[model samples]
Target: MSDEKVKIDVPEVPSVLPPAEQKKWVETYKAAFEEAQNDDPGDVVKQRQSALREANRLLRVEKITSADQAKALPKWKLVQCEEKDGVLKVVTIDGKKYSFGVGRGAKQQAPAGQGGGQNGAGQQGGGASTPPPAA
Candidate 1:
């Protein structure tokens, strides 16, 4: 074979946002991901807090990098972070913003078959119970 290298042509994928904006968001995501993975330790309380922060960061990463959210990344204008809560909330291009907490965007899963949607009307055993067997 000759010393000349083979050239491969790669097609550019179309994006809703301009390349510069996409690059900015991609860099932001990379920074956030790297920040979450840093595990430098401090005092006991700080260490615990760090662990919790790491966990929340990982959860946020999973949420944002998911298939559906990944597609929307180019449209994200801002990433709002709550350091106390350790949550990173994304603001979309159309100005929709949401914070993390109970019932914000995070969902609390009910135990399997528990039907946790009831409004505390003493609805336990809400399913029809079988009548007592004839004596």
Candidate 2:
């Protein structure tokens, strides 16, 4: 395999959140989402939407440029990934949406020293790699 390092263009993550407010955002989002899920008011959709909006407002997504960046984002804050026009859009708790095109000529290269080689077999006098019986 070619020993070329694949250049994966990751999304640009903005330092929007302050260190002090990290916990606050996490707690607020969890509480609001949980409330909407458990309370089950008549207008469940509306309630959930409102909660999502608040969470989104607090999330303050600044710049999401690519799918790799979107994937790199913390899973806790992500709601889902939507596809549109051959692009993958990342939706973060009803916040600003960002998308990236797939198969944009991204190269696939293996690391320099980690070639696909056979793993050590029967190192412990066994045909397959297995653990000793429980004692």
Q: Which digits, one per residue and each the tens of the lDDT, describe model 1 over residues 96-119?
A: 343332334433211112242322
* TM values, all candidates: 0.21, 0.32
Candidate 1 — what's its lDDT?
A: 0.35
lDDT of 1 at 122: 24
- In model 1, where do residues sit more than 4 Å from their true spots? 1-14, 39-92, 95-135
lDDT of 2: 0.49
Worst 10 residues of 2 by lDDT: 108-117
Per-residue accuracy of model 2 over 58-131 as CA lDDT, tens digit each: 66554665667777876655766655445565667535544455564322111111122222111234343346
TM-score of 2: 0.32
